[model samples]
Target chain A: MNNVYLYNDSFNELISLIFYLLKNNIKPTNIKDVSYNPNLFEECIFLGIKSKEQDINNIALQFGYYAFRCIYYVYLSNNESKELIIYYFILNAIKYRKKITYMRNLKCVHETLRIAEYVSHETHKMKGFTRFKEINNNILYAEIEPVNNILELVSKHFEKRLKNEYWIIKDVQRRLFSVYDKKNFYIIPEENLKLEDFRISKEEKEIKEMWQLFYKTIGIKERKNDRCRMNFMPKRYWKYLIEMEDEL
Target chain B: MELKEKLKILADSAKYDASCSSSGSNRTSKNGLGNTAIAGICHSFASDGRCISLLKILMTNCCIFDCKYCLNRKSNNIKRAIFTPEEICEITINFYRRNYIEGLFLSSGIIKSPDYTMELMIKTITLLRNKYHFGGYIHAKAIPGASEILLRKLGSLVDRLSANIELPTENGLKLLAPNKDSNKVDKIMSYVKEKQNRKFVPAGQSTQMIIGATKESDLDIMSKSSSMYDNYKLKRVFYSAYIPINKDNLLPTLEKPPLVRENRLYQADWLLRYYNFKVNDLLNENNPNFNILVDPKTDWALRNIELFPKEINKCSYYDLLKIPGIGVKSAQRILKARRNFTITFDELKKLGVVLKRAKYFITCNGKYFMSSSYFKKEFIEANIVLEDKSIENTKIEQLGLFNE
Candidate 1:
């Protein structure tokens, strides 16, 4: 009989489920997220436990801190089988201790690292691809549609850089917003955000026009290659990029 | 003129310069509006496929010299515009706040004198730094023939300082840009190298050399680049293809820039910097130019085929990097993955190694990945993918705006 374990969508919930299964000595054949559909051959077990911070820290202490981070980052990805991958990766980590991360030949460990890398790579790219517009000449607002749950990671970067300004980063894919108010930042679900209320400041149009002109003027006419431009800045990003809007 | 018109004129004049990197400086925001990430960030890509990291522009298009190849030469019949110090700071702050740019890259044509021009640039950066409290990346051009005092002051204010060599050889400079003294360029590079403190030009210095303009071969250009890196510890050396902008007795007329040669030179430059290969290893007196048919590394690997079929599990990190199609990251991955289990040929692809080019060069437990019939140089040569062949086929002539 295949025993399947299920958990809620957050990283903390996943950690709590892993801790419960490990403590009870129950080996899960398939780990399914709450949104996943179970097969007829699998016996599902749902552990709706709100895990403590100490439990997560204990897992980090047992498996190395980097291994814990890799699992956390992989949890942020949109992979369907990510929970099973994490469960198998945790089993390997418990056996091999800190050395399991270097074993890329292991299927579970390789997928865990690869998925974690994809999440961080998207976060890095969003650092440059995120464009902001001034709203009411006071608050800065930008929108992103990343495939992973990296909105919080990107907000942490801007929190250090634009500390003095009020900013909001909206993850359109996840329907969440990371709002910063000069002192700190907080991530909240899109509750009552009126899309029409987000208006561009008076001088914003002029500055954007000037930027578009500068963008066009800087490219050499002799070296004009749309293929090359698309290679660096992919086509999926063109929808939100102000400079690429005209071409789209 | 309006600010928009001034920006267009200055940006057009500054487009010839190929140094657009805003990396290697890490200044956090402390009581300021911006900060510089050490790894740098490219905000946009221009239609030409080049990264637009900084708001690259000239302070003024008006000049005192008539360099035949420059668009902002004194003899050119173009509209001249200059920005005040306050105006540049305002533009930089606004653009940075909106995330339109990572920082500012300010270069200018010599207005009154070299020292005078350098002083004006220093004033602009100082205002941006102190008055506005802008802590973004700033890459400023170190004006040739400027005084050491002025150079020192500008170096402290900016993140990176670069002096353009303009041409590859001294004779090329004499023929095209007679007003530019190549020795003065060397003096600025040495000054930055000497004053290599934490606060003085924290990102280090770099230089750019125009390719395909003069009669210098790829060997000569790579040799000069190798020596510059050895001598001055430059962060990077940019290679800009000579676009046919000037029609003079000394300049050669062409349909378009020799972009293929520029691409090849950049490939060889990467091999010198990262792959631990010398200029001589890639090119000798017998073979002066890179094979336009294949990349420099692949060309070397094909020539030195006796060292092939390196055992993937047994080779050192340095030997793994020597194999074609395996980059630094993949080689390190191989090293890490091999410690746990022996890597099979199928698993090599999963470990980030490009198997198409690497199959002929590497082995999995002393067994070749591909059949022995495909091990010949002619087979690999026929199958190797060309990245930019279409760039050579399409021919278009851009009308000369500066050198007309």
Candidate 2:
């Protein structure tokens, strides 16, 4: 009999599900979140099991830190088979410990490493591509629609880099905002945000025009290649980019 | 004058420079508004497909020297503008807070004297760092004839410093930029090398040279880059294809810049830096220029075909890197994965190997991935050329515009 595990789309809940499977030695046929649609053949197991902070620490201890990180990053990737890949990845990791990491020839191990790298690469690109606009009372607001669940990672990076500013990073697809108050940040839902309260500053209008002009003139006219521009900054990212607004 | 007008004049002139990297600095914010990442970040891409990591601009376009190749030469009839130190600080801070750029790249034309120009740059940067408490990456251009003390002071304030060796040879410099001396550029490089205590230019020094404006071959250019790396310990050497801005009798009249050659030189530059290949290994007196068709690595592999059919499962990491398509990362992956289980040809593709190029050069488990007929030089070259048709089309189409 095949068992399919279903849970919410949260990293903590995913960790709890992994712990439940490892503790009970249950081999899950497929692992998915609540958003996943299931077939009639498999037995659906709704996992309401939640692991505490200590249990997560135990999971980290059981599987090596590097392997645990790989699993977490794989879970964050947009790959449809990432859950099953992680399921097999953890089982092999627990069986072989450090040796499994070097076994990249295995299908599960290779997929796990590849998917994790893709997510991290996207996060790094987001760090550079996220553009902030000044709103009312000198607060900064930026919106991004990334493929992965990378808001926490990107927010952590800006927490160190842009530590002195009050900013909000809104993940448009997830409908979540990582709001930072110059000291600490919290992930809040869209319902809590007052859309009408946000107003663009007059100075910001002039600055935006200047930036758009700068972007237009900075490129060499002799070397203009739309293919190359789209290669680095994909067309998908153009929706939020102020400079690319004209091009789009 | 409005700030937007001045930005247009200065940034248009500064667009010719090719260096926009923000990597190599690890400066963090301490009660400041910004910080620098060691790995660097590119904020945007220009329409030409170049990375824009910094707000590259000039302090002023009013140059004293009449460089024949420069758009901002003294003899050129163009509108000029200058930014005050306070104006620069305001723009930098505002743009930085908005995350429009990683940092600033400030360069200038010689005004009155080199020392006077260097002093103005120093004042602006010091104010930005001290008064504004800006902790972001700053790349300053070192005037070749400036005093050592001013260069030293500017070096400590900025993260990266560069002095462009505009043309390759001394004759090219004399013909194009008569007032600039090559020896002064070397002196600044040596001075920066001596003051490498991490407090001075923590990201190290870099230099750029214009290609196709001079008669220097690929061999001559690569030889110079190799020496600069060894002597000055420079971080990077940028190659900018000479764009025909001011048409002089001494300059070659071309319809478009030599982008293919510039791209080939960068490929060869990576080989020198990462692939452990020397100048002589890729080019010599007989073959002084890169083959504009295939990449430098593929060309080198074709020339040195006796070392081919390297066993992917048994070859060392460096040998795997020598393959035409296997890069450093994929080679490391192959090395790690092969230790656990034997890597097949299909598995090699999964490990990120570009098998279209590597199939002719690599073997899997003592079996040839390609047919024995592919061992012929002509056959492999034809197939490789076919694989790179898109790159060839872009180059030819750009050059074909001039021919018509």
Candidate 3:
């Protein structure tokens, strides 16, 4: 009879590498009964694969990090080719070792800075564009669906300015919220929840009234610069601003 | 008096102030009601499209000085309202508890005298801090003629302080805002700096200068900003592109102030802060203004093509920053990613570098590559045509992508 070893294809390469070092006398074991033994392998590999459908998604995260780092280097150098170079570098670095600090000495740092500058620039633009609405629970709830992963970036600015308050900034597209409680910051995934029915407090009503009054009072009757106002604060953001609610 | 009437009068008075930023300071709560988490927040927007993070209102709209440019100038016919220290504290606390505002940004029009107005503003902030225990950010305007002692007192209470320069040039100030002395404004800014250095204004000081109202060129504005940053240690020097609110003979009677020019100044300002560029580099004796077509960095790159194709692997961080489309974050990322691998042009595209603008300025491995020819004259012409075509097409496209 021929001795054959059966293992899950997902773990085949890792198991094959492990099997090469197994004791010669140990045999006759079912693959289903095989358990990962940290002591058996000289190097331990942890693979995070969810369901079959999520396997690609899990792998893509590692690739996304590589792509992000590559683009960042390209942007820093003001050089366009540094990105491609960084991509190959990431692939090679992953194969060689877990640490990639050696890549910093490779001359691509300049280009990565250029890319970081671009990302920060877009994040700044979105900071001005993001809008918040007052919900009934005394929570200043703002819902933004930015094209980029900018929730962490934008939330930092708001958290500083609104220091003494409790607020929840929800990125509806990403299904995540940065909840602040005057002391600490928590980023949590919001389950399937509809925010439309959230209520506002009585205190909020009086404050909104005061805010609307203040907005109306500030503009000079004789010197209304609709063009300049529109130029800085566009009509698209009016829907979320308290004063523009009537127009919306 | 009715709260509504007072709010209208005070808010109307503050409309001219262009510094709407709610950033920089990070104040948190221990057992108090509020916190400043380092990330700023915007509660709402106004009719003029400015963010309303705080209930940014004046303590009073009544003025003693007859500055010709201000809507609240003593001679101007407008309704006046004054909020007492108690009134301000009440409003700030109420609005803050309800999450209507992040904090208070209190400015005033000299009600009786400069000392009197400064004292009132200071008292309001002190009450909010000591009595009310309000820990939220407060940005107060430093009255130009106020004493150093009072300025220091107010600076300690508020998170940020600003004294409006009002005009870029001394001659401009003399002509438009007659009551304001340019030297006095400078003295107040210097005092703010002296105190800030001595640990008075911890969040730093900011100032606003009106553009286009006076005959100060872009060169004059950049020079003033550069000097302000160097001498005063100002956090920011805001540019409020002058819009002719009142038809004064001294002010320019244009249909609109140059919004694009104001935008360009901000771009140039960012370059000064983050890119290690100087005011002289942005504008020289011949070209005293930023180019209207492209951004300042791009304009600089096109004129000084000798600096182009900087070797990605060999250039220092400072040299890399000079390239068009490359900014502070991208520079830092490149420095981090270049360690483990050799970077190529295709990878840079994925990193979000503006290839269109950067391709002309950088090279990898002694090789220059771009989608089009690297010749300056042809590239500019092609880019202009492409931009013009895109602008024409965008007019017909629906703008729902930006809608909330």
Candidate 4:
């Protein structure tokens, strides 16, 4: 009989599930994490079987820092088999210690790394791609639809950088907003939520218009390549760009 | 004037400068607004597909000198605009907060004098760094012939400093930008390099050269870049293809920019910095220009066919890097994987080697995956470059089947 695990895709639940699987020594055939669902599994497991957070953290750290970070990043990804990939990745890591990360030739570690790179690449791009506009006078607000669940990952980046300012980086697809004041940030996951409409400040409009002008004029006329442009900043992410909205 | 009008004039003036690098300095934000990364980040790609990592703008378009190729030359019939210290600070802080830019790339034309212009730039950046508590990346150009005291003061504040070389040849600078001399530029670069122990410009210095305007060959450009790297230990030597603005007798009579030559120069530049290559490795007096059809690496590989069919299992990392298809990352991957077991053709491809280009040069163990026809110099010469590798891969598979 095949053992399958399902979770609501939280890291805490993932740790508990990992602890439960290891304690019982039940090899899982499939994991219904994020976008995955398989019909071949015979038994199901949810987040009820508890494991200490400290235990999971300690075990994760033993597998090397990069490998452990990859597990967390893999959890943030929307990949279907991320849970299973991490399960195999952690098993090999514990079985061999730091040796598994160097063995990129392994199928399990390779796929997890590919997912980690994808999620990290998105986070890096969104750092530069997030556009903010002043809604009232001073509150800077931006809306994004990233491919992965990276709202929490990027929250630290903004928190470290934008201190002493009121700012909100909202991931519209996840209905999550990381709001930061002068001191700290709060992540709000509202149910059935839509961003409220407000009048754009005149100074904000003027600033964005200036930025749009710079974006258009800065490019060389002789070497215009929209395909290259799309490769880096695809049209799917254009909804958030104030410069692209001028075309509408 | 309105801020929009100033930005239009200043950005148009600053567009000719090709230095957009924001890497190399990993400055941390000390409870401030932004941080710099050693591995650079591209915020967005403009229409030309060039990465717009920073908000590049000139503090002023008003100038005293009449450089023949410049848009903001004093002789040109153009509107002049200058941003106040407050205005520049406002733009940097606001744009950075929106995450539209990595940081600021502030260059300028000489307004009243080099000292006066440098003072204004210093005032603006100091305000941004101190009062605003900004720890973001700042690349400021050191005005040639500025007082050493003023230069040292300016350097202490920004992350990176640069002195524009403008053109390759000394004669090119004398003829076009008459007032500016090569020696003055070198003096500023030396000052920045020598004074780094004082924490002045912690990211080091870089220079830019405008190509296609002068009668300098590719040999001249590469030779200068090599010397600049060796003598000054420069971080980068940027090559900007001359775009005719206010065309004059000294400038090239071109309808558009010579972008391909500029691109080739960049490729050759990369070989010098990362690949541990000298100038003569790719070019000499007879071979002044690179083959426009293929890149510099393939061009080198073709000339020295005796070096090829290097064994994947035993070749050194540097030799592997010299192959046309293998890059720094792939070569390192080969070294790392070889410690476990001998790397095969399948493993080589997985390690990110472009087997299409590398197939002519590399072999797996004792066996060459390429056919005997591919070994011939004439045959490989005829097919050294293809338009795109995707289409060429299909052709190669069919050819492989026939050969088998």
* Candidate 3 C-alpha lDDT tens digits along B79-140: 88888899889988876754567788899999777898999998889889988888887889
lDDT of 3 by residue, A1-248 (tens): 32223233332232232233232333322222124342332333322222243423332354455544444323233233332444334344444433443344433433444455555655665555554546756567777765555677777766664656677887777799888887666777887444567786555667777766776766544444454466555565455566666656
- lDDT for each residue of candidate 4 in B1-404, tens digit (9 for 90 to 100): 99888887888788778888888887776777888877777887877888898889999888888889888888989888899999989988888888888899998889878999999999999999999888888999888878888898999998889999888888888899998988989999888888875257877789999888999999999999999998898999999888887767767799878888999999999999999888898899889987887889888888888888789889898898898888898888778777766778876765556787788788888778867556866667677655455565886686568447
Every model's DockQ, to 2 decimals?
A: 0.57, 0.68, 0.20, 0.51
Task: Tell me which of candidates 1 and 3 scores higher on TM-score.
Answer: 1
Q: For model 1, what is the error of residue B187's alpha carbon versus the real structure, in angstroms, after optimal superposition? A: 0.7
For each prediction in turn, the share of the native Cα contacts (below 8 Å between chains A and B) that it retains comes to 0.74, 0.79, 0.33, 0.65
Interface RMSD of 1: 2.9
DockQ of 4: 0.51
Better of 1 and 3 by DockQ: 1
Score residue A134 of candidate 1 by CA lDDT: 91
The candidate maximizing lDDT is 2
User: Distance (Å) between predicted and true CA of A34, model 2?
Assistant: 3.9
Winning model by DockQ: 2
> After superposition, which runs of candidate 2 have C-alpha atoms over 4 Å from their true positions?
A35-37, A52-55, A58-63, B390-404
Give residue A10's lDDT in candidate 1 (0 to 100): 77
Per-candidate TM equals 0.94, 0.96, 0.72, 0.92
* Top candidate by TM-score: 2
| Tens digits of per-residue lDDT for model 1, A9-113 | 678888788877877888888777777677888888887878679878866888889888899888888887888898888877888888888877778988999
Task: Report the lDDT of model 4 for residue A5.
Answer: 79
